[model samples]
Target: MASIPPAMAPSTANWHWKNKNVTTWAKTWFERELPTISVQDDGNEVSVSEVVDVDGDVELGQRKSKYVPPMY
Candidate 1:
């Protein structure tokens, strides 16, 4: 898998992770951009201002993975 880095490296520290699998996955996942999709609420039509979280970091930051694997 050329897209995948040839190594598994952990960020942060050992003390931060109780589960090694999750920590390892996080490292790999962090190297890619997460997808961003926008969908309307199926039940209602809400204004952008009504749903936006201006104060939260979740609204401010982006996901890592730039591509989606073809198998997906």
Candidate 2:
């Protein structure tokens, strides 16, 4: 896939004739953003958490909850 120009974006409305086809465009935008990712703990103390797919944009502002350690 070719690189996107400054004017064109991968949205519903396509400007150039090359971006009219949505089938091939899907593969062109194969990326994994950090917003739709998360970390989960499997009831372990010294284990690393796994990042899961949450979908959609992630909130960048404010925290909703507090952190609590299993052992303190």
Candidate 3:
């Protein structure tokens, strides 16, 4: 998107041109952009335990829980 004019601040209504059709332009641009990120985790087990009542119940704002390994 182009920068907003200095004298006129940006508002939700006029952020971008509403009538102009830019569907083709957007599709073409994204086709060239490649995603290059990958995530892998070592073989490990994570355990989460409840800290309050084992009955699986707690009042609002009166309950606390934590992960067993504390890293997950």
Q: Which of the numbered candidates is closest to the native, going by highest lDDT?
A: 2
Where is model 2 poorest over a 10-residue stretch in terms of lDDT? 58-67
Q: Please provide, for model 2 over 1-72, each residue's C-alpha lDDT reduced to its tens digit, 9 standing for 90 to 100.
A: 345423333444333233222323333333423333455678634422433433432211111222222232
Better of 2 and 3 by TM-score: 3
Please report how far candidate 3 places residue 38 from its true position, in Å.
6.0
Give the distance in Å from residue 63's predicted Cα in candidate 3 to where it truly belongs: 49
Q: Please give the lDDT score for candidate 1.
A: 0.31
- What's model 1's lDDT at 64? 35
How do the residues 1-72 of candidate 3 rate in per-residue lDDT, one tens digit apiece? Answer: 333212223345553432323344444333333222234569654443322312222111111221122122
Whole-model lDDT for model 2 versus the true structure? 0.33
**Residue 31 alpha-carbon offset, candidate 2, angstroms:** 4.3
Query: Pairing residues by index, what is the TM-score of model 2?
Result: 0.18
Error of 1 at 42 (Å): 33
- As for candidate 1, its clashing pairs are 32-64, 32-65, 33-64, 33-65, 33-66, 34-63, 34-64, 34-65
Candidate 2: Cα lDDT at 64:
24
- What's the lDDT for all of these models? 0.31, 0.33, 0.31
